[model samples]
Target: MWERNLNGKDLQFHLSGINNENFIMKDEQTGSWWQQVSGRAIQGPLKGSQLKRFSHDDLTFATWKREHPSTRILEPDPSAQEEYAPADWEAETAELPVVTPRGKSEPLEDRDLVAGVSNQDAARAYLVADLARQGPVNDRLGTTPILVLPFEDGKSVRVFERTAGGQVLEFFAGTGEELGRLVDATTGSTWDFRGTALAGPLSGSQMARMDVLLDYWFDWRTYHPDTDVYRAGL
Candidate 1:
């Protein structure tokens, strides 16, 4: 998710049903239009400004509650109960916009989930399935060291920088929740799926979470033609 403000003014957002398939949002303040998926202000006073993005993962509400038990959740509004009904919104299949590279082919399926990591001009994507099978994958993007970890269910993933203090740490997948989801070989700290330490010498400490975009492999490849894909099958 990104911030919704420009020039020190917070712009209220309203879902403009105009482009339901592409995910468009409008600001109540200036009637500016935005693309939610790309976090780009398409039209209006903030056209050139980009929304700041944070590291986020897509998870089921139940899983989220389990991960963050103390998390506060939004209550459904009584007045919009009908609008919020699932039956009111029917699913539609539409092709996402794609821009194929001049000579390269996409390595993964169009709809497969990919955890895309980028630093300035460098980009890399790890297939969710590969991450699940491999457990913790440590690598570098540009000069930044990173680690990719998948949840036990194999559908969710999180990324974090390997740097802590003045040294880089190596990690491996832990047996289960009792020992945490990830264990650092250097310090023996057990880190949860979200990169927070659960037990060991570094208990209660957290790793530096990195910004990652969870997108369809096709969509991510269209944007980053030079991206390297992690493929366990290969």
Candidate 2:
């Protein structure tokens, strides 16, 4: 009769009697000693022996004492000791929540990809910010940040406008003659003009205009996670 986490939550694990439950029942008349224990295997092969036919309470006591040797010398009755049950109960219970922080390196997607405005609407933000690896921000728009999002048409880059009380009144990343002009030039459901040439496919002029918008986003610090940073290198 063994419990894995006594007074705690765990499977009803069985440990075959490991030749440890040695009981000595003294015989007063014969002056002999009768070693008593259970016949059931608590663990191991049937090679071990414990005098079977013992009461449940007695068997429980023996296993308890075997696991916690200090309890062997002390009387088993809880009433005899004040708060004994509570102390043992607490010792048996698990308090701290089990959390394993190992190997949790999956890439986290940011729900707030639009930057300032979307960030405000989002209740929580998730981006792995680590200077040791991802490094400080580098792009056309900002510095030392873990995430960036491109501007969707009708939406300009927004830098948050905070008040004295730390309340955000609005967002204003930026808008300009160049920015607005490009917005008009591009055509897409998202107003994300890919800048294909009128002649066909992508031409030098179309690609050039695309670069201008990307530079604006980088300068304003509203980074598009989808955009490649390598383009700036050339």
What TM-score goes with each of the models?
A: 0.79, 0.15
- Candidate 1's C-alpha lDDT? 0.74
Clashing pairs in 1: none
Q: Candidate 1's residue-wise lDDT over 72-106, tens digit each?
A: 98888988976773642312222444443334455
Total clashing pairs in model 2 = 25
The number of the candidate with the highest TM-score is 1
User: TM-score of model 2 relative to the true fold?
Assistant: 0.15
Q: Which 10 consecutive residues of model 1 have the lowest summed lDDT?
A: 87-96
Misplaced by over 4 Å in model 1 are 17-21, 76-104, 176-180
Cα deviation at 91, candidate 1, in Å, is 10
